[model samples]
Target: MAHKEPPSPLLLVRGNNRRVAILVISILSLLAMFFLTFSPHLAIRHCGHGEQQRSMATETMSFSSGNTNDGGVSRRQARFTDLNDLTATSQAARNEEHVLILTPLKNAEAYLPRYFEMVNRLQYPHHLISLGFLVSDTTDRTVQLLQDRADELLNRDPPDDDSSSNNTRYHSVSIFEKDFDFELPEDRRHEFEMQPLRRSFMARARNYLLSAALKDEHAWVLWLDVDVIDYPASILTDLQSIDVDVVVPNCLRQTDENESMGYDKNNWMETQQSLDMQKKLDPDYVLLEGYFEFLTGRYLMVDMPTHLGKLDKVPLDGVGATFTLVKAKVHREGANFPPFAFQHQVETEGFAKMAKAMGFGVYGLPSYLIYHIMNS
Candidate 1:
């Protein structure tokens, strides 16, 4: 009966209070552990810190998952973007244009191979070059050779670039095999005493070539002598870059190491003012054509404006066509090679005089020299 007695109320309440106290202490201990373990990590994230480490982790994940389809597609897209950039850059480098090269070869059989060499050496785009030949009264195989070569050049690309897509440029040949023989002896034919007749003949020949070769679509006309032995491959581009109305290079004839002298008398220039002054001093004064300084045998080389720093272009009363770059407009606007006496100047000199009267500038490069074939 004593063992079965009911428990006291105060004892029960005390037991409940002790259990509650133990529960509160356990909860406070759990909260303190959470703050201590995670507070540093949270602070670091909120303070914008450890960004480099995060980036490294992201890159590591990307590399580890690189075998995925998404990674492969991204890599392919980046490669395509690079290829597109390269193609755009290369396409911008093709600076193509139209140009005409005119040559008159009567007995140029010997020079045919060399002329082809010059053509091969030309740096201009092959598609942009239109070659024209004027062959008349030729006793040699010049006509046949020129025709065969022109056909070959037109039908196929140049020897160097087989993949070139530029073969549309047409080439032409004109043969006037008529005999234009003079009754004079061979020695007297090229004599200085008979210069007017010789120059007039030459002028007539030049005019015929110009009339036959000119094309309105051609922006420029390069009068190149087949006998030029030495010249830069960029000669055309160099002169064109000057952006002048008309320009000529210094043509030189080399005899010996010490005996070389300037050639192409037409390049030797005098201002109109000086020529007029000379005329005033002597009304009948004649400017001897092709005249040069004594002892040196070179034309009076004078200073002119610098074209590309390496080349200087002097204003001139006359110009030589041996290496002349004449604008097509100069001919289209009424300039031609005068065969008759123009102030006693004939042939190319007369052409210079004619061009000047027509308001065209004639310039010469003193330092930029092109060599002529010996005895040509």
Candidate 2:
């Protein structure tokens, strides 16, 4: 009889509320199970998309950062997107470019004083220029003289009032000594028959100096022969303005009363005869300019009239290192003076051939003359 009395209004209301709460809880549980079964695929898709975007961003960053080594591209190729960009930076910002001046010396004591004087007269900021020398196979006091002069040039004190004097000191000086153990009697050094052997040694010396002195910071390289007696103070600027990968001024022999004649025939353009002759010769046989034995009839830059404008440039197939200017990237890309025959030429001429083969322009300024001491 007491159980039958459970039909009270308050009790009925409480029972309905409990059933409603339980039904709501059961619906929520079913919804959560459905979400757990499908939501993992959606979450994975979103995360995968984000990961793909991050990978693409990382690859773009690597390319712009010049990390070409990882991509198998050369540093030289990565630095300039286009080869034509090898031209020097604007003249207004020329001081920003660092130039390495390299000289390969052999018994050059007699010329060091004049060479230093010429170096001192250069209008290019000395602080932007580094000096490098390779002393190879010498019997003279060249090393001592070079050391003494380097000391004087580097250690010279500037007058307190001269604000520009600090820029007169070279950025750095590096002297390297290595002997090739090859020698020619002084009297026969320039003989036609001895030129091949002599120049091969010279090539080895130049390569050694370049590899030793070339630094990542250098933008240009000036290969200067120590025997050059005279050049314009603006030679560096003049050559750079030509905007070629490799350029040389006409090398002339100094004569009494300042008259000059072509001294370096190494700078020449190949003639049909020369090419034909090269094909017939042994691959190892080297060619020579200014020699009667191998007459290929190549046109010499020296033969070009000197009355041409100083900045006037002509394409060259070969070049002499006597006051040559090269873009540093050219050497970095593997163009160098071959000690053996390269395209039937050796040393400086071989270097020109190599550069041209590598798709770089080689040129000469016929009227931009630099004087070489008369060979003894």
Candidate 3:
């Protein structure tokens, strides 16, 4: 405009480069903003998908392990602060309580078939039940029979469809082999004279099984004898409904005739006479039940046939484990079947005494009957 010379080529090139740099910077800034605005939503969707997959896997793996002595507290157990809240209920809601069914076996091959049959017949959810067996000093094929039964139940195919009602698979099954070296002839096993030593050995076996098999996930411990043949399918829920720390049902010996006689005299209420006997006996003296030599005058559950109400609960000072259902916390809180004399009692009775000493209630359903196999 004022006689200016033509612009230099080098200067023109430098200006064009500056404009290009600015355009590139502007595009990069806009792309970063777009990613920042939407990244959180994508991240949240991915994280939720991962969590759902983990939950489903955990449910499928629950108690599928075999023969574990780990007894370590599980994450699931830690999540439960009060197991009583999960107690069995008759309400329409699902039953979340986990029950451990423990049995002590000695030459029990004959009973295993019927025992597992009875277990299968139970109406309680099998997925919520775990089985523990202690095969101590067995001369028969009890261990093999037990293993076969466990395999049959655990390895069965799952239901064909979600709507199928047949589900007999147990949550877990554990088989423990320990020899207590206690043996008696079949004919003389129940002799009153053999009671003390026999019960002492039994106490040791029970203590061993309890320690080896009990797990933190178990909400309840059910001591069911292998010889027990017949019970209501609702036995678990029925006992749990009582909600006592320790509870037992009257175990009656099965008869060819329809007569009902109490078979487990161990379920008794101590009398003042029994207390006096305990005070006079040596600290090591173990008391015997169902014998006349040491009649402590205790009230026996089997003797209470008149109280036949299914739900009638009677406070007990001693309990038999024939069909006992105990809150797991009772055993966790240091109540166990004493291998030694405890308050002049041993075995299951000693367990009751120990539980009561720990400030837990002991009870029995005097008229609620569970049948024991008839022994000749």
Candidate 4:
């Protein structure tokens, strides 16, 4: 062993310590560099993935349903979006066209489930639409059912998905309930007195519902009758594209012959003759629908120059609000279902007159049909 002399222990220790320090520093530096570089890279990748997930989700998605059947008809998509905020903000968000589905619920328990099912099935993003219910004078489990649904909605988490930003929960599920001492024979609302006692109260009820349900006037108000049983899922999309001050989709009911009839009592093209005649009638003359059933027939036909190749916005004098879409400004400008007569019209008709007076275009979609549940 020609080691000239055993290297001094101190020297050896110092050399070893120096190499150890260098190695430790190198390892720590490598770790720091890796963390600084790769950590950000990982985080950026994660964020990008999240964003892509949301984008892709909204881009490619349909409904998931098939629980309830209508007389043995197997359903394809869930009748309603249920609470999922799917289609939270579709293309309609371009001009900030969100809608408040305002419903005045009265004795709607039996139909609530089906109603919601149909509503959820609407081909619009539930998130962009706030559901407002003014439950007045309901005796059945309508309020309770609404409460249960509200609780479920409140507790439901934003659906777990790669993309759920816009499709998050709804904007609001407001349910304002109170008792109105008024009573209309559940089946015969039209049969009862149609004057200050009946028609005016109906207007008041509608107005109250509007006041309570409308949350500011940033979005259009779609006064959807709770009794509507069937409607196109794309109803929202179709109506929004009409681009009018106010719009009403012709609602139809199935007659015993299995044919259809215009069910909207207030939906009509006011003729000057009808107008003058209406003026001559008793001040409390109730506006009756279906008088020209045989002449005009029922069923709206796609018969005018309109948009989307499947919708028409016909000028109207007065139409029903069975499924009316009123611009928020119309109400913000004091156009509402008046409790008193307005130009020989009352309630929804009066609302139309007010809108007209305000120079707001009131259009009707005749060909586009929505079904209403009768008795059942």
Q: Rate the local accuracy (lDDT) of all candidates.
A: 0.67, 0.84, 0.82, 0.70
Q: How close is candidate 1 to the true structure, as a TM-score?
A: 0.64
Show model 1 residue runs off by greater than 4 Å: 1-95, 157-179, 183-186, 256-259, 271-286, 291-299, 302-308
Model 1, span 1-376: residue lDDT tens: 4577677543465656877867887999999999998897555333245776796555444553223365356532111111121111111115444567878767789988988777667766666677777776677899889878877777764556545533433444334433456344446754556666776777777787788777545667888888888899888788887767788887878886645666676676665555555555433323544433212122444333323555666777777778788877787777888777675567787888888898888888887878887673
Candidate 1 colliding pairs, count: 0
- TM-score for each predicted model, relative to the true structure: 0.64, 0.75, 0.75, 0.67
For model 1, what is the error of residue 305's alpha carbon versus the real structure, in angstroms, after optimal superposition?
Answer: 12
**Across residues 15-80, which tens digit of lDDT does each residue of candidate 4 receive?**
559778678878999999999977853553245777978865654455454565756987565333
Query: Which candidate number would show the highest lDDT if scored against the true structure?
Result: 2
Q: Predicted candidate 2: what Cα RMSD to the true structure?
A: 12.0
Better of 3 and 4 by lDDT: 3
For candidate 3, the 10 contiguous residues with the lowest summed lDDT are 75-84
Predicted structure 3, TM vs. truth: 0.75
Candidate 2, residues 1-376, lDDT tens digits: the string is 4466556543555756977867887999999999998786455334577797896666544554333463576663223233444435536125478889999998988889899889988878777889999999889999988888788778777557554553366788999999999978989987889988998999999999999999877889999999898899888887887778898999999777767788989899987987777788888887888877767779999899889798998899999888999989999999999999898889999999999999999999888888999876
Q: Assess the local accuracy of residue 263 in candidate 1 as a C-alpha lDDT between 0 and 100.
A: 68
